[model samples]
Target: MNRQAQAVVLLLLGGAVLKASFTDLYLRYVKEGLRPFLIAAALVLVVAAVMTLWYDLRPAATAEPDEDHGHDHGHGHGTGGGHHEPRVGWLLILPVLGLLLIAPPALGSYAAGQAGTALASQQVSDYPPLPDGDPVRVAMLDYASRALFDKGQSIGDRRVVLTGFVAGGGPGGEPILARMILSCCAADGRPIKLGMAGNAPTGLAEDTWIEVTGRYSDRVAKDPVNEADIPYVTVESWREVPVPKQQYE
Candidate 1:
């Protein structure tokens, strides 16, 4: 395509990025902190594209008549003026179309199943007593770390609530609760899995968000894929819930 066509593509690309960054759609791919960067990059693309279009498509100054010939040949975009661009450049439009039309969802259970569960950090140590609540909320990572590294000493006997999506089950068919944690984007995301022991829910579809109240149980299982640790909890109750605004932690 020529400069004008390239400018149109560039404009569409900018619009796509701006749309994603301005809405919750961007969270599906990159961390929230990168929204500002996305917006900035989009603005730069838009400005550059507009400038290029203005320079390339604007009316050309009419040339003065030559002294000898006294003729005024028309001067505008000529048949041979088009730039030769690689066909591969056209592929960029595909992602732009997807972002503008159908925004993809955040990583979930099926993604979790595809990769081996990553163990919550092994630096487990004594945790301070949980704050006052009938059932204190505990992060999945914290629960896993304490359960695996500290042998549940920090978690103690307190009833804790955990939130994550249902990711099938363990090797023995025990129910599993999982959350994907990302350092930057979904490409770098990893799943944290916890096996449910008692009173666990059943038959929930993959990616079903849930909140479960359970006491920490001293149990651990190996991930069938890579033999990584999958912690355990003895669930007392559970209920389905809507997916959170921020699916990944």
Candidate 2:
């Protein structure tokens, strides 16, 4: 391929990658720390383009034209070029294509209890009663923060919306232990626990994406292992969904 063509192919490939959900992960994890890597990748394509142009501009190599084949060597797939033809870099495209085709599942049990853990020490007195019929949407992080900030207060029957990746469940799952991603910082993160309600989507597993809509109850739900200290939320509705590109964006 010529220099212009190579550049155009690379540019298109990059644009497709940018459109993918994995691109968000790339920005979060790789872009922040690897400015030089991006620069180097660009520079490599530039060099390939320049080489292609130079090859095209130079005198064409002449091979004997055959009567039947009619310029077999000269007018073959080879355009104005040196002895070499540009090779498609499939290896470079492989990973990018894989990510675009199939996004990996969200962080599972390994990072479940660890990431965005809900607060367990909220006090009973601070929570206000749930309004008559208002639908409240609150980020898991925010809810966790409120719990920590007003441990002395009660988070009464207020309708709240929580979003996060699923986590903290076994193969044979329980209604509780749903997970959510916090801000970039896991320490500040919070995952709300749902009390056994209606059957959750069975096919979905931990680290699956979901949105949980429910009213907060003042009653504290504790973990069985540590009955003394467990934070829980009584769930009214749980719905599985695609993981949003921006978990904390």
Candidate 3:
């Protein structure tokens, strides 16, 4: 790409990062803690772009005598000044265009289905009691970990709330609730799925966000792709919810 294209790419990339950082959109691609860094990095890109434009628009440097070649044929390094850049450099425009024109959804069921279930890396067999809420709001990963690892003692006799998007499961490809976990970005995202049983909503399309109030259950099923055990939730009530500001945990 020429210097003009390069500057535009830098400007566009910086603008995209600024846009994501200013809104909740960045949460879809990265963890919350990275927001400040993203802003800083974007500022740097913007500065670099401004500098490039300045240099490109400045008056041309005085042409030195073609001392080596006697005359300037300008055919490249025969006594050359021309340089070649790989055509692959143009591919950078694709991502710039994608970020500008496309508002991609957060990683949802399809991404979850493609990867193995990601649990907390730390191994903890003990868990504290659930806080005193009839249907305590529990994070999806926390519920999954406690359910599978601690044997559900922490959740004993309590209905808990889980917020996530719908994924297909159970009989006849019914909807199940799932929240994705992202360690870094969407590329590393995966889900902790809860197979819903009682009163689970039907006919929900994939990626429809929902809040489920459910009691813990002992039912478990092996993930078809990874063979990891997926725990169950005996859903008592559920309703569609707007997608959270931060889509991943």
Q: Where's the lowest-lDDT run of ten residues in candidate 1? A: 67-76
User: What is the lDDT of every predicted structure here?
Assistant: 0.86, 0.51, 0.82
RMSD (CA, Å), candidate 1 to true, equals 3.2
Which order, best to worst by lDDT?
A: 1, 3, 2
Which 10 consecutive residues of model 2 have the lowest summed lDDT? 26-35
Off by over 4 Å in 2: 1-13, 21-91, 108-133, 152-154, 163-166, 170-174, 177-179, 182-213, 217-230, 236-249
Candidate with more favorable, higher TM-score: 2 or 3: 3
lDDT of 1 by residue, 211-243 (tens): 999998987888987788888999999999999
- What are the per-residue Cα lDDT tens digits for candidate 2 across 150-247? 54144555667767655554223453445544444333434454433433445556667777776544344445433323344556787877767555
Which residue ranges in model 1 land beyond 4 Å of their true spot? 61-79, 124-129
Candidate 3 residue lDDT tens string, 142-186: 898898887788888899999999987532356667888888888
The better-scoring model by lDDT among 1 and 3 is: 1
Model 1 scores a TM of 0.87
Select the stronger candidate by TM-score from 1 and 3: 1
**TM-score list, all predictions:** 0.87, 0.45, 0.83
| Candidate that scores best on TM-score | 1
Pairwise lDDT winner, candidates 2 and 3: 3
Which number leads on lDDT? Answer: 1
* CA shift of 231, model 3, Å: 0.9
Give the per-residue Cα lDDT of candidate 1 at 66: 75
